[model samples]
Target: MKRREFIGLVGGAAVWPLAAQGQQAATRVIGVLALESLPRTRASLAPAQRRLAEMGYVEGQNLAFEYRAADNQEDRLAALVGDLVQRRVSVIVAPAGPPIVAAKAATTSIPIIFFTGFDPVSSGFVASLNRPGGNATGISVLHTEVLAKRLELLRELVPRAKSVAYLRSSTNLVSDHDRIGKLQPAATALGVELLFVEASRPDDFEGAFAKIVSAKADAMLVSADAFMFSNQTALVDLAARHKIPAVYPSREFAARGGLASYGTNYPEAYRQLGDYLGRVLNGEKPENLPVQQVTTLQLVINMKTAKALGVAASPFLLARADEVIE
Candidate 1:
């Protein structure tokens, strides 16, 4: 968060006082490697912090959270990870996506904990789920595995829609192409055409939306990834301006006013992350800890947004939703 001066302020806030009182070992520090500004991560971070507190790891008494946020810049991640490593934190929390990659690369011995939508094994974050053979393990939602279901939900929200726009980040071309291949079968089965558009950087968003408009897509599916999630406000605004119904990968999007979202339970994932963090802090090796897979998925609908767009969510779908925003 406050990296410059605070980066130097580690061992922990309680470090100096405890050392002066001959009790320097009284605190444990959890270094967080965030991919966005600290404020942006508050929603995800709170649950983990609260869960930790419930487990008796109270801040300013027995715990400290030292963190480094890249402010949404992937390039800055390596340096931030390096700083966290240098701080000699008891545990490192990489907040999904690129930051995890950088954290793993930067440290092999330090215990690393993360919550990722990406497949942990294929992404090389772990050797296996049942037995993580390395110093990193946390919640794995495997969002790609649910792509088909997400598409089906979009069709449910936009019945009679023949064309749907799918917006994805273009930073990883090979992976994106692979993901698209997986989604095609679902599109074919639904008899809906998926118009693909991409934006890897902020500057490219306008052009991507222009392409979506030109394609005349009846609805949009914002792919699950940190890039899209971080820029959700802009994406939601663009969808509103275009008046195209859209379903997002994370509920935060629908909460920010996208039509709806059907994806992994994010806050729940972080709570699970907190549980693992506490486990590791209590002298457990990451290699011995099996990665936790979050199987719960949730649908969130914003009722006012649906009304504003002059679209009605299927009553059947509404009844099944975990939360419907008014």
Candidate 2:
């Protein structure tokens, strides 16, 4: 994609028109609280806006968005959500796990929409999936359950891999620990030793890669989280520098030259979120709208990255992938 085209696709176009138009008398403003920076979070928002536009809510026309990015700082989320709540936004849209948690805590009266990988009910974000029973509901990607399958795919791609390094954000300790717990047995069953690496910031990436190399990990499976996703380019470069085949959770990784990715279609989920937001704005209650589960999944492989790592792409995997980067 051309630079301008990519920017528009990712919702990075200038917001001059949006700001100039201000909030219409009947237009409702939706607060978007993202856990990462604008550039990193744009990918998740583009599809949602497109979906909303299709549902008759045009930016600067019928709908206005109040966006705030925490830039991966957990400490700042509560304050950000509080500002949005004070602004009296018609609804709140949280892109990552923590932002959703913060939004839920910030207000109970305003409807909140979320795109999360964690179990809403288990995480205490909702009463149940079928009926959220509150002013919150959106979509679930079911990321935890896919741990086994991700490991299986990594092993399938690198059969002789004796060790696998798992990278996660150290800041989100609870989720990080839970993810490792879920993947440990699966790694053992596949006869692969699992090495854990925690890096909470961009500056920690080089050291983390050094640790991965020292641990003698033959491949890596990156844990899915907002922090990790924020440093996608850096992570992809480090994996390539170490010549270690790695798998990620989203196609954006593969698009940026990661070896492979297997997970829910994130853009589709965002589009669904937009549709649901439209419904909420049009006299529908969040509790009444059942939390939707992402049914479509995508597998993406980058042949160039595969070759750079000296690993040949398996024909079976290539055939099954939804997209391949040559």
Candidate 3:
């Protein structure tokens, strides 16, 4: 038997028939705080549930979950996280930067597992990757440094493009600033001009697309964030209506008919988070677990979107893509 199973068996032997002793029952609860209500965020929660089940924790038995979403409103996050803390959850799982920030501010005693794209050290989320030294610990997708490579690929796919419009969320200003600082120097070296458009809210997408058109950008790149991911369909439709080729940071964007996307697989990251949570629940400290970095990045292209934009995806780019939605 595994260590946890052995301990459970031995403990149960000593505390046999606790009900006979009239002892009250206790259940462990985990709280999940998501930045927005989106399919991708919902999809990520399943693997975590599955992992917990494998570790002998069953929902409605000894394990329970409290799920809350900000519904794409940045202002609602603090309230939602506070609600979870007030409920006194044993552990909290936060996906995306904003929700994680809110959870960190809400409690220091409860363990927090986060999935973020920014560098946790630079963002001050932790002391170090190897030694988080606090209740917060999980995975970092390390997105800031990859901006140049993503831009290079966009340039490769559209060699004649002189100007590129970059869409970013105003709420994630820290990430946006870091991305621009890294992207501009590489863009200059490639002789390409980068125009930034801010889409702080869903209503801003239409205006952002119009700005892209006015800038006469040959293509566009969207910075990764939960807000953008949540409104992906609207962005895809807008790009299609405007006939502007675009690149995104997740395959889900391309799957929804965006031109192309390149980034780490998000669902797999959640699965890893589940494993880490299991360790923590089994008496391991968060500080002892090193923060994970995603190594598998996927390249995806949508043939239909490319055709609609009147651009043929180069054979070289197509060959390198992990998935091609036709």
Candidate 4:
């Protein structure tokens, strides 16, 4: 090689390692705790990853994940949070209220970005939505706040739905109280009798459905809870087997062939959560970042499920749906 070329090559080689080292140093590890099953969690996070990429975060290049899923097991959350805490990830992103609550209990100093269904202040996850005033902050979807809307949709779907069944997990009593308190008045106003059923685990699903059948519920409204999301398939299947019309709080349920669903766009909420995570990684304090409320309510209808249940989706309802799965 020529002498000048040899010197140039040596200088280039010397600079490469420094650049790689700096890139490695800039990389951040994000810990994720999901209360839903792993497959659902991954599916929900696809948009979040894309949003992060759009914001200049590339996994394995500058961002890393330490992911843990509860797989419908609420008891596993604490251990998962402990593992993430031990790893000392740059930020913890928890989707769903249970895992977020567990993460909050596990650490007060770790920066946590959570995607929740209820108000953060009422849930005690944060001091306030405007200013978190603590280490935890993220998005809140109006799950409990929209119980009346879900009931309205159910009533619309089944015009003769004089008896409506409400299903939720038994583990979160506080959420149950909040949900029931909101649902009762709406049920009365709609002239529908509400039958409440609780399922703490997957095994309890069958029994809960049996109770709904016995109660002769014309339709069902499933609460927006992590356990319910985790067991969505079973719930949808059971509702079909019993030939009952059901409305869920997430689009995933309708996509999975449930009768209908109405609520905030959760994947969009997760995308916002990813954005907040990136901001925290860039040195924004969780306390300074206001908790975000997802406002884009989506209505999803499954024509196939409706037809199978012998229910007609009116032209008006179909036109109003954000998405209709055939």
Candidate 5:
């Protein structure tokens, strides 16, 4: 039998049902603050829930979940986070940077576990990676740090592209000077000019693509922002209608029919978030739990997308990709 099942069996033998039920105070209530659809938010959180269950946190029994989503509205996150805080959630589980920032501001005492692509320390989420020294701690990826690498991969996909259109979100703070600024030097080294396109909401995607097409850029690089990630279906559709070869921040983009994506395995990062959640629920402080770093990167390419875009895949590049959708 599983450890949790065995423990439950053994514990029930010693304590009466009503007496044991009084221990519900020890149950963990995970408040998932998100900036996307509730269904999508819950789906993304499945990995974390599974991991927590392995550590004996069964949803609706000894564990519970509270979900609040902004539905892609950046301005709504603060209010949503406030609701979670008002509920006195045991811990705040947020994905990406924006929600975490809101959750951090909403409550200083609640433990926060995040799955972000941006640097946590630099974003002011924690004091340091090795020692968080704060109530907020979790996992981060090579997101902003790997901007140039994604550019390099895009260049490989379109060798003769002289200029590339880059998407940036006005709502995400993590896309500040520290992160987006690296693109300048990267584009310089790759001999490609960057045509920056700014889009803060769903309505702006069409206009951004229009700017890219008007600029006559060879390709596009979608920024690694939560807002953009949540609204990627529309973004992906626009890229197709505009016929722009684009490189994305995660494998989900490629799976959704984008040309290419190079970045962290999000599910694994969420699993790490689960690991941290388990630790915090088990009486460990967030300050003592060092922030986990996402090291597993996936290079994903869709041959179908490549064929439709008329971009020939180099044998070397194809071989280097961790996954290719034929």
Candidate 6:
């Protein structure tokens, strides 16, 4: 048997039946604070739940979740986080920078575990990566730090394009100044003019596309923000209708019909969140758990989307991709 299974079996033989009954009666609560809709957040959190289960945190027995989602309305995050704080949940897990900021503002005593797309230190999520020195700690997707790499990949996909548009959430603090500033140098070095297109709400997506078209951008790159990811379908559809070759932040976008994507595996980041939360539940302090940076980057290309957009995927680029969806 696997180590976890073996341990579960051995632990069950001793004090499980009786102790588990009492534990079931008093479930350890985990609050989920998210900016995405409940359905989307829950779907994204599956890997977390699986990881928790592997650590012997079985739902309805030893663990319970109190879920709250903003459904893309970022203003609702503060209220949702307040609700979790008032409930005094044992732990609060926040995904992405916005929710993490909200949770950090909500309570200092209530342990907060985050899975963010930007640098945790630069975003003020933690004091430092090696030592959080506070109650919030988890994984960082390093999206902002990878802007140049994403831009490089986009340039590779659209080599002859002289200009590129970066589609980002107007309200994304991480992408607005920091990531955009980082992309400028990369764009300059690549000999491509970079344009910024902002869409805060779902209603602004079309307007952003119009702005891109107005700027005469030859290609586009979607910023790695939760709000943008939640609206990937609409963004991908817009890119298709506008006939702009686009590169996204994750494989899910490519799988949803975008031209290509390059970034860290977020589901695994959530699993890391779950594992860290499990440790916190087992008496580890959040301050002691160093923030983790996701290092496993992936490139995904959709040959079908490339063909539909009349962009030829070089055989070499396809060979380097981690996955290619036909």
- Residue range 1-326, candidate 6, lDDT tens digits: 89999998988887768886786567899999999989888988899899999999878778999999998888899999999999999999998778998999999999999998777887788899999988999988778778899899988888898999988876645434777788899999999998877788899998989999988899998999888879888999999999999999988999999999999887888798789989999989999999988888989999999999889988999999999998
Residue lDDT tens for model 2, 72-149: 888899999999999999999987788988999899999999988877777777898888998999998857888778
What lDDT is reached at residue 274 by model 1? 91
lDDT of 5 by residue, 123-239 (tens): 789999989987888888888778899999999999999999989886545446676688789899989998888987788888888889999999999988777787878988889
TM-score of candidate 1 relative to the true fold: 0.89
Candidate 4, residues 1-326, lDDT tens digits: the string is: 99999999999999999999999788899898998877888887788888888889989889988889988788899999999999888988888888888999999888999887766787788888898888999988888888899999999989999999889886553655777898899999999999988897899999999999988889999988888888888999999999999999989899888999999887778888888887888899999999888889999999999999988989999999999998
State each model's CA lDDT, in order.
0.85, 0.86, 0.84, 0.88, 0.87, 0.89
Error of 6 at 156 (Å): 1.2
Location of the lowest summed lDDT over 10 successive residues in candidate 1? 170-179
Off by over 4 Å in 4: 1-24, 173-175
Clashes counted in candidate 5 amount to 0
Worst 10 residues of 3 by lDDT: 19-28
Flag regions of model 3 displaced more than 4 Å: 1-26, 38-40, 172-175
Return model 6's CA RMSD, one decimal: 7.8
lDDT of 5: 0.87
Q: Which ranges of candidate 2 are over 4 A from the true structure?
A: 1-23, 171-178
Pick the winner on TM-score between candidates 1 and 4.
Answer: 4
Model 1: lDDT of residue 54: 89
- Model 6: colliding residue pairs: none
lDDT of 2: 0.86
lDDT of each residue in 64-153, candidate 1, tens digit only: 988788777789999988988998999999877688889999999999998787777777888999898879998888577788888888
